[model samples]
Target: MHSQYKSRQGHTTLGNTKTTVAAPSWISDFKEITKMRLSISVVFSSLVGYLLGVDVIDFKILGLLALGGYFMVGASNGFNQIIEKDLDALMERTKNRPVPSGRMSVNTAFIISSIFTVLGIIILYSINKQTAMFGAISIFLYTCAYTPLKTKTPLAVFVGAIPGAIPFMLGWVAATDDFGIEPGTLFALQFFWQFPHFWAIGWFLYEDYKKAGFFMLPTGKQDKGTAVQTIMYTIWTILISIIPVFGFTGTLQLSIVAAILVFAVGIWMLYYAIRLFKLMSVKAARQLMIVSVSYITLVQIIYVVDKFIR
Candidate 1:
């Protein structure tokens, strides 16, 4: 639900035109508005960071972190839809969202988001001040900065990556209650990974995006420059992912064995990136997108497993 769907006036889910073929129920609408699954994935990233930083798990902290992270991301998504309801209405993939499709009022969405913002901050504050600060900043940067920049410039991806990258490091801060090279390393890994992941998504949806005036590609089109940057970022992502093996990342240590495993996935992702560069087709981009998800998820799992066994 990073940047999702649009509207068709005078409709209640069109069945999601019902992608259920039956108008989405209120329960379904709630899920759609909050972008529930996407929010959960982001929460999982924060938990992974917490695991890397903590020597012993604290269930209280873990539960709080998950709740706070979900509220924060869900709120961001809700506000994003409110702002882009019209733009979302213009895209086929987004047209069924509640706000733009007349299933919910804008004011209602705003209230829910505002409540989430307050509740998310409070929950994070219960953990520690540093965690709370980062949570607020993530929300502000996403909704205030990144959300608006989507249609203004392709560099919106750069801006968006800021909030997108925070959950990983935020968990570290929650665990260690410190900001240092350890969390910085985690942030850098996620930060660079987003470029290729998001770009591939942009490539395949370039046409749909243009309908809403979105400039997702670096050059604003499917071209050599975009492909080259994809490869470049993929390389950067690989470099950062393996850096923990050097043992300079403090608490965020990666064993040589784990680093090898991480490198293998990075190369796997890189191959797809190169294919995208050579082929420059939507199909190639789609393949890269799928591999990138696996690459990131696998590398993180390796880090967490290495942390426990090493």
Candidate 2:
């Protein structure tokens, strides 16, 4: 009888230990539903934009911008997962996410996302009206237009790029308190960069995305058509990067040396795109993705440095 009691007690202890270990893992699972890494990247872009926008740095505004940008980007990402949770369950890459994996309730996710949406907008309002409006617009477009369109058509990439480009341009407005040629220039640069960046992502994730019913590429199949179009857009991206060299785009001018350097990076990226177009293999697609990342980061650095040095 004592042996039986001891066995039962041991079982109960193990059960409790299991429960305790599961709890924190569950909370972490919930956080992963928001695509935290992607939001971090978005916040980084916003921070860089904010830094480049202002002549003098104000840590206070930077704090507000970071806080507000995180929530805004987080909310956008959370709602994106909520809307796509069902679809995510079908994709290998996304099937383990909190919502799709049943670690977090969809309703709970929605409520948290909604809360962040409002909080983010209010915080941005504290910075400037233009910033607030831009933040709100980004949320709306990402959730409303980009989220749904992903399953419906390939044009979703184009639609999503608008909001994606806004963060960099947003800083110019946040600092200058107005929309002018400078912001427009910033907008143009980021806008053109998105095509190559996102297309490379789409290309690399094409198989996983197809499982989720997302036709991300213009070709709608992992084929030469898509690769060709990606190369075309990359060429356009390179062209736009050098535009400010002419000094015709208002105060957003780039020096010949800066343009040459920026143009070299662009060509390097385009070379990868060209390789993808020729090879049409996953290896080439992966290289294009790497080059695309390098391209954007380098271009932004060049723009900010040129602004200061020249």
RMSD of each: 4.6, 6.1
The lDDT, on a scale of 0 to 1, for candidate 2 is 0.81
User: Who wins the lDDT comparison?
Assistant: 1
Instruction: Show the lowest summed lDDT stretch of 10 residues, model 2.
Output: 1-10
All candidates' lDDT scores? 0.92, 0.81
lDDT string, candidate 2, 141-186, tens digits: 9999999999999999888988888888777677767777777777
What would the TM-scores of all predictions be?
0.93, 0.89
Q: Between which residue pairs do clashes occur in model 2?
A: none
**For model 2, what is the alpha-carbon lDDT of residue 243?**
87
